[model samples]
Target: MIKNIIILFIAFLSVTDLFSQEKPFWNDIQKFKESDRFNPPVQKAIVFIGSSSFAMWHDVQDYFPGYTIINRSFGGSTLPDVTGYLNDIVFPYHPKQVVIYCGDNDLANSDTITANEVLQRFKLLFQKIRKQLPSISIVYVSIKPSPSRKHLMTKAAQANIMIQKYLKTQKNTSFVDVYHKMLNKNGSIRSDIFLQDELHMNAKGYAIWKQAILPYLKK
Candidate 1:
């Protein structure tokens, strides 16, 4: 009986470890929360939230001069991750507007994640924000194309289409077509837009984003 009890305890710990690994980004969210406790963001500002794409936009304020924008992105985050920590990042700021760039990470995180699944997840997120921040102006930047993740581009493109269609039916929601814009004239991912990793965007890519996204932001 003693040996059986010990084995069960070890098994429980293993399961707990696996659970923790599944949500590794939780700690990153907590850190951001703790930071806010000290130097909180300006209320009613524009929040750029999502995965590494927004997290690494180190010069975002420079890109959008004279805008009250706060960057709360944690790298490798997914749509679910953003929704999971919305209380910390989104709700806390009392944002007047929001721009999101996610979904690619969800598709890249697993092979089984479908375009429809991503679309549904995004719809869920949209509904949640609407229920809470009814007057908020929200923009969804389409999943970008990448040289390294080109194999998944088709699904990402499909997800973008679904999201676009859905957003059209909603009020005060805009879909920035960054996906199509990121492609070259030949309909291929622009090699110059990405960094050395061939995954994340470079300054040129962000420039494209700035042009596409700026017009839609609340003035």
Candidate 2:
């Protein structure tokens, strides 16, 4: 009976591992890398990696023209997607800094993952990046609080707290708190900052982001 139980445990572990494999976001990564939106080869680059926020920020170069900035953003990508391809998409560029924005898609997609879990994945991704490129700096952009996703506001705030705390201990990691800046007097997202759907940002939103990020990029 003990031997039979051991065999069954092994079978169960295999099944669990199979179910744990993440859904593919590689197709979008592949397409983005091939598209005109991706930055060309550069020396001492600064990479921006994330979801639609990063993708939609079209004026990154205009904001930080002094450094070679590569925008490797794909719309609707979650943390797991960016974590999977960090080596190929980010490390090869030998960037001085990487600005990351993710997690909104994870919450929006009904993943039901806890705030700590999202923080853990961010830690894992940072570890992977460090293993390949030890000297590179990591700048984590706070997952902005959206009025449209007000139902998940608690989740977003909790995740930001975890991320902020995590950033404090790391050597070259920093948190960019765009959430507080985006809020209006009533604590809703500033409607003037976002586009039509109130999900993504407009030029004014990008301008605020540019001002917040310029100091770090100059460093």
Q: Count the backbone clashes (under 3 Å) in each candidate.
A: 0, 0
The TM-score of predicted model 2 comes to 0.83
**Alpha carbon lDDT of each predicted model:** 0.90, 0.81
Judging by lDDT against the true structure, name the best candidate: 1
Instruction: Please list the residue runs of candidate 2 whose C-alpha ends up more than 4 Å from where it truly belongs after superposition.
Output: 1-23, 32-40
Candidate 2 clashing pairs, residues 3+ apart or interchain: none
Least accurate 10 contiguous residues by lDDT in model 1:
23-32
TM-score per model over all chains: 0.88, 0.83
lDDT of 2 by residue, 83-167 (tens): 8888657876788888899988888888578888888878888888878878778898889877677777788889999999988
Candidate 1 error regions (>4 Å): 1-22
Candidate 1 backbone overlaps, count: 0
**What digit string (tens of lDDT, one per residue) describes model 1 on residues 33-52?**
78888987789999999999
